[model samples]
Target: MATWISIEGHRRLVEIIPNEVQELWDKWEIRGLILVSLVSQLILIVLGNRRRYKPNICTRALVWSTYLLADWVAAVAMGAISSNLGEYYENNHKKFSKYYINPQLLAFWAPFFLMHLGGPDTITAYALEDNELWLRHLVGLLSQTALTLYIIIMSWKGNWLSHLTIAMLIVGIIKYAERTWSLYCGSIQHLRDSFLRTIDTSKKIEQQQESNNDGMNFWEFLANSIQKDFENEERRAGDPRNYLRAIYIFVSLFADMVLSPWDITQDRKELHDRGCFHWSTYFTLVNNELKLMYDVFYTKAFANYGIQGLISRLVTLITTIVVLASYCKLSENKEHQVVDQIITYLLLVGALLAELSSFFFAVFSRWTRHYFRLRGSATFCCILGCIIDCFFTKSRVHISMGQSSFFTIICNKSLIIKGNFFPVNKLEKLSSVSHRLTSEHVLQKVYRSLYDKSERSLQSNLSGVPGYRSLLLEKNKPIFASEVEFHRTIITWHIVTDLCYHFYDEPSYHFDPRKNSKEMSDYMFFLLVKQRQMLPVGAGLITLRDTVIEAKRVFEDINVVTQEDNLGEACRKLLERSTTIPRNEDLRMQSTSILLHACDITNELIADAGEYRLPMWDFVEELWVQIISYAGAQCRVDMHAHQLRRGPEFLSHVWLLQAHLGLLDQFQIIPH
Candidate 1:
């Protein structure tokens, strides 16, 4: 240790008597630090292999990993002096460049980072799976862009590396822009959904309020509220509206589950009554929704730019131009080229980190607004991690699957195998046995239902009111009541379909899992395999079915599509203040249960038909059964209901998305 100097009367310790004598503490000594860094890298790999640490601790492991890797590599050219004294001796003859700065390596790896960002439609995020997590992806991409630009600058003299990096950047920007556009389109769909829901609710409430003033009983009032429609000015007392309503519900979901096979293509025809929106309506919807999404998407950029676009753009442009000029000028200085490289690299790194920080502020602002819950916020964080490669060490990233890497053509042409939801989905042969086991069930229920005669009488009286029709005996009614009966049914097949292996995982969810099966069992597996979510069409068709049911219970006839009236008997078992109940009471967990269950039923049907793993589209047959059941029932009850009401149109669109995504078991083709 060096002695301290004292200026007062106290005895002073001697400093280095001469500048040349201090040379011992220079370049050669740096070797030890470099060696320590190398040792640390090996230690980390060992510990990671031994399963001694967690991947997402957000500290310790991740920090030390990056520091060790970056610094160790940096020690190369830096540690190259002939001796520690040479570092400071001003050796004019030495060119201090390292051969390790290979342009080919940088050229190969930079773009691989970007390819990892595509984000599946089934699950657009990792780190956080929430739909709102896209904001994080945007930020991560931008940061990576800045970092890549810095590396590109350093390697610009290497023409091939420079050109490759530029090409990757262009492709990356285009891909990112496309994903943003897709998400924007989805947001538009969501807005349309909200609008339709509002309109339906408003009209229903208005009619009910009028009924209450007329002194109708509570049952009557509820029924009227459930069924009334405002769009039709020519609804009649005994029209065939109920039949149309049922068929619409059956047809929409059936079509979505079958021929369409994806949620993105849900058609307007599937909505209860909202046909293809007029061109003007479509444009207005797109513009408004896009405007709203953009506000949400670019919120961070806006904040950084003082919440004004013109100012932000001008400032960014001016700043970038100034930076480029400075960089170019600095590059021409031969004496300070090394210094220039380090400064440029530092600036680039700093800017990227700043960009990331800024991205969160914008995303967090929205996360705060929409989720307002811990899980939601956490989801955003997780998604951010998934979209950005920053969380994982370089060794862990799946270079092949990344956004910036060479595009690959993976052919994982297989899907997850599944089975049926319940006994009802068993094959005709097995169903025979299933039915025998339950033969006494129907008779027992019929007589049991009669025991509640008083309730039925009350319901009948309510349904028979002047303007409304009876729920059960409507002019057009259920060809069979089973369509409505499966309302509360549970389906667990969707989860099974997600088991197909992911091919392009760069950083496997588990870094060390040789000894822990539990760790293997439940994990955030970063896979290219598709996860699951609800389709707009499934939700829409279900909505249409529910709307029709609500209509029958509230209004007596389909002719009253636009009439504001009451069916005293038909009422929901329960009502939420806003937002109707879903097909299943999935308060949490996830939404693709129906699709999953459908897959199960198909599997079961296929199993019974022949071999277990065969491509028996028998599941499609069962789907048709359901479609026909609902369609026939709706056609039968046409004269029974009082009103013809419209349902959410977005479900049709979701159905289309499902079809497009290629998990098409629910949708099947039936030839004439």
Candidate 2:
């Protein structure tokens, strides 16, 4: 009798603990999760929308954190709710159960979890790699759908909310499935193969029609319509008026699609010939291209664009609103705690508002305007265009007269200019320098330097000619430069260029090529440190960091002017003060050697460019462009695909642009 009593006491204690925990969890769990889910969705819409405006570390971290946590919180909440519901069911079936039961309430809440699992369309996946896990998401859909259905069926055996629960469950399944399908469709290989298949089908049909047009079959009609549509697409793609269409064509080229080089050149020429649009257009176009890339890789953009998507979205919105209203009615008539009633009402209102906002954003988007062909009203189209333009057009980096690029530098990275971390007068000086450079910048300097080298190469090629027969052949073909070599060369060259500019006191090159070189060098370094995946193979942050540490160490030993006030002074001091020291230290020896090599190259360039009258700045600019182009081309398509997880980089854009312009050496196909 004593043993039996002890066992009974232990069982009661175990049961009591779970009941207490369940009661607490049931009261606060759904309310808290609903609040968090609603807030996360709002944060994503607001903060995520501003990502393009400010591409800094803080914004990126915040967005990434919110994106990850939002999904995690909602999923965890579902599991918790299901566990509590199961516990309640077992207790209610007991002969002397301690827990109070509300099967109807439990049934009503299960569908909300389904909706949470569906997630907001604004964020399907945070990065490109997330899309690659579409199969995993599909698995999640199956498991979660099964769990939700199980909960709904078990809880709503005699519940009035059963129909509403089923309705919501259907809506949730559709949304979650859409996200998974969009991910599969957006994967790079899949997207590319789709285009290839379309091209192949068109070709096959064309051949069939040519062989037997008299027998006008369904295939022939379909082929002719496809051909006609393709022609119309190409026309629109080439037109300057449709920037979005142009982006689509260029993006296809980057995807390894076989676009004619001549056609690309002609289209570019036409755009340039039509207007002075190149300067401002490139910035806007790049932004748009990145936006499209983001949409394709990160969001439910493709899934939510078509007529079918529109209809499905409409149905989802209507059903969700109707179900929410039904729940509100149930709350009003039922006897429930005031706080619980208020919380339920809040979730309903929040869901409705979120859906409404999403609908509005979609309607006003540039993609919608282009797709629906709603251009009948001139005033309406103009207004819509302006609104869409506002989303992309912020403070642009315009190289104009009397403007400060100091802010541009700051925005790109933090800085201490002229011993002042942030100051008004230094900003004024930087602006004046920027403005002067812009007004006086020359393209010929770059052209003449490259042209002279090309002419020499051509002369060497034609050795049989009277002037070239005696020319000596090169010992070997030039090796493709690695990323380390590129970085080391540019940093050393940038320093040497500074020394030359300051030592010679040549004011002419200072404003144009000198400034341009400094900016490009710094930008490349920034890319190396912050965006390593975008760079050519062999470029590592570790290598850059080690180099910088060595540089600082050498500079400290030299002690020239205490802090190396500017680029010119830093270069001058390194060459004059540091080189005078003994080459005992390995780091210092390496630094001195780099300085000497840069000087030697500069001398050779000067000798080779004799009497050509090409400004030194022009030669430097040409060399920089060649270096940039080579690096860009060396990066593979697979590398670009890998960047889906991290986000797009500026260098990738440069690579694509270079390929389009036929600047990349390997991409230079002769128009046969």
The C-alpha local distance difference test score for the whole of candidate 1 amounts to: 0.29
lDDT of candidate 2 over 1-672, digit per residue (tens): 011223565664323345556656546776677678767767776676554333355877887898887778778767866776777767665522333335555556656656665666666776667777888988988988888877777776654468877877777787778878878877766766766654555557646655644443222233344344435534433232345435544556545666455444544443434334433345446546666666666666766754556677787789879988777666454565566567566666766776676666666765555444322245655676778768744554322112222113222223333321234323222222222222223223322333343334421221122111111112121211211355565545554454555544545553476666545544454444444455665533333334333444455576633232354565555556544555456654443234444444445444555655246555555555555445555676656554533445445555555443444443344555
Q: What's every prediction's RMSD, in angstroms?
A: 25.0, 9.3
Q: Tell me, by TM-score, which candidate is best.
A: 2
Which stretches of model 2 miss by more than 4 angstroms? 1-26, 49-54, 93-101, 157-160, 204-245, 253-277, 373-484, 497-510, 539-557, 564-570, 578-596, 599-614, 638-648, 664-672
lDDT of 1 by residue, 1-672 (tens): 343566666666557434443343332244333444434333432332221112233444554454335323433323232232233235442432321223333332344234223221111211111224556546755765666565555446654435544654554444344344434323324334533443344356655554433443212222232244223545432122322222222323322222321121232222213323232222223222222223323222222222232243334334434444544554444533363355344433333333333334433342222221212245654564354335332322110100100001001112111321222111111111100111122222212222233223312121112111122224242321112222212111111111111111223233211111111111111110111021111232232223223323222232322111221111111111112324455522432223323223333433454633222222321222222222222221111110011111121222222222221233233223
Where's the lowest-lDDT run of ten residues in candidate 2? 466-475
Error of 2 at 280 (Å): 2.4
Best by lDDT: 2
CA lDDT, every prediction?
A: 0.29, 0.53
